[model samples]
Target: MNSTGKESRHVNIHIASPVEEVYSYASDPANLPEWALGLGGSIENVDGQWVAESSSMGRVVVTFSPENDLGVLDHDVTLPSGETVHNPVRVIADGAGSDVVFTLRRRPGMSDSDFRRDADMVAADLARLKALTEPGQGPR
Candidate 1:
C-alpha cells in the first residue's frame, strides 16, 4: 500500500507477467485512451469529448504522458481552476506481477457523493487497465 502525505492511493493487482510488460503497455497515450474511462463513467459523451481542451466547462488540459518504451506514465493534468495536479502512476514488480499506484495530492473539492462516484469510476478504470495491459487481452 502507498500512503504519501497528501496524495498517494495504492491500487494493486497480481498480473500474470513481469513488471516490464506492464510498464511497456501503459506508457503509450494512444493505448491509454482505451482505459481512460470505465464502464459507467465516461470522459466523453455524445455531447462532448474529454480529449477536447474545452468542453461545456472551461478549458481543461487533456494532458498525458509522452510515449516511451518503458511503461512509465508520469503525466500532470491541470483542472480549469488552474490547479496543476500530478497523477503519480508508478509500476513496481510485486511477486509474479506488478503493483500499480496512483495518487492525487489535494482533494479536488468534490462532494461526498462525487467521491463515491469517482472512486467507483476509477476502480473500474483500473480493472480495465489491468486487463488491457496483460498479455492476450484486448481493449477493455
Candidate 2:
C-alpha cells in the first residue's frame, strides 16, 4: 500500500494455501529475508525483536498473529525519525486457502515508498508460502 495521507495505496492478494501453514511461515522472523530481501536492501535484522535497524527501508516487524486459521497482522513499525505507524494486515482462510488484506495508515505528508515495498514483499512471501504448502508437489 502507498499513501500520501490524502491518498494511499492498498494492495491485496489471495494465496492458495492452508492458513496455518502460511501463518507459521509468515509469523517466523527468520523467514522474512527469504521473501522480503529488499526490506533493508541488505542490512539484516539483528535486533532482539528481529527488526532491521541498519536498513535504509527501516525495520518491518511482526505484531499480529492469525487465529490459527485466520491470520491478522496488526503491526506497529517505527520510522527513521522515531515515528510509529499502524499496519492492519489481515489474512482470512477462503476455501482451501487464504486471502490477505493489508492497510497502512499514516499522515498525508509521508512518502509511500516503504509502503509499496512492504506490500510487494508481503505478497511475495505469501506466494512462496503457497508453493511450500502445495501437496503432491515438493519445493523446487
Candidate 3:
C-alpha cells in the first residue's frame, strides 16, 4: 500500500542472464505461456491482439508494451468484465545477470486472500522465467 491508497507488492526474481537476453525473451507475447502460467495455459495473436484462451479469469486479451532498450515488459490484461489491469514489469541489469521485477497491484474490493494469492502467482511466474532464462536453459 502507498499514498495512492492502492495496495501493491513488488514480486521479483534475479535471473542468471543478461538484461537484453531476459528482456528479449520476456517481451515476446508468443513466449508468455512458457513462463506466465498465471495468465493462461496458452496464448495466440488473434489478428493484432494477443488472446489468452485458457486463462483462469476466462478468455482475456493481453496488450504488451512496444519493444525498447529500457527493458520494460509492461502489459495490460483486459478481463471478461471489460476491465483492463495494467501490469508493470521490468528487467534491470544486475552485475552479470538481471533482476526481473513485477509490480502487483490490488484491485478495489479485492479480498486480502485474493491479493496474496495474486502475489504468489506472480512470484511463481518469475521463478519459471528465471529457470527458462538461466544459462543452462539454452535458447528458449
Which of the numbered candidates is closest to the native, going by highest lDDT? 3
How far does residue 69 in candidate 2 sit from its true spot (Å)? 5.6
Task: Itemize residue pairs with steric clashes in candidate 3.
Answer: none
Q: Which ten residues in a row have the lowest lDDT in candidate 1?
A: 38-47
- Alpha-carbon deviation at 2 in model 3, angstroms: 12
- TM-score of each candidate structure, all chains considered together: 0.65, 0.65, 0.93
Q: Clashes in model 2: which pairs?
A: 2-9, 3-8, 4-108, 5-108, 66-71
| Span of ten consecutive residues with least summed lDDT in model 2 | 36-45
- lDDT (CA) per prediction: 0.57, 0.58, 0.90
Kindly report which residue stretches of model 1 are placed more than 4 angstroms away from their true locations once superposed.
Answer: 1-8, 38-59, 62-72, 106-108
lDDT of 3 by residue, 1-140 (tens): 32342887999999889999999989999898899999999999899999997547999999999999999999999999999999999999999999999999989878788888899999999998998999886556
Model 1, 1-140: lDDT tens digits are 12233433454456666777777776644455467552122233224323423332344454566655454667665667777656666777887788776653435455555445545655666677788877676642
Best candidate, TM-score = 3
The clash count for each model shown is 1, 5, 0
- lDDT (C-alpha) at residue 81 in model 3: 96
- The RMSD of every model to the true structure, in order and in angstroms, is 6.1, 4.3, 2.3
Consecutive 10-residue window with the lowest summed lDDT within model 3: 1-10
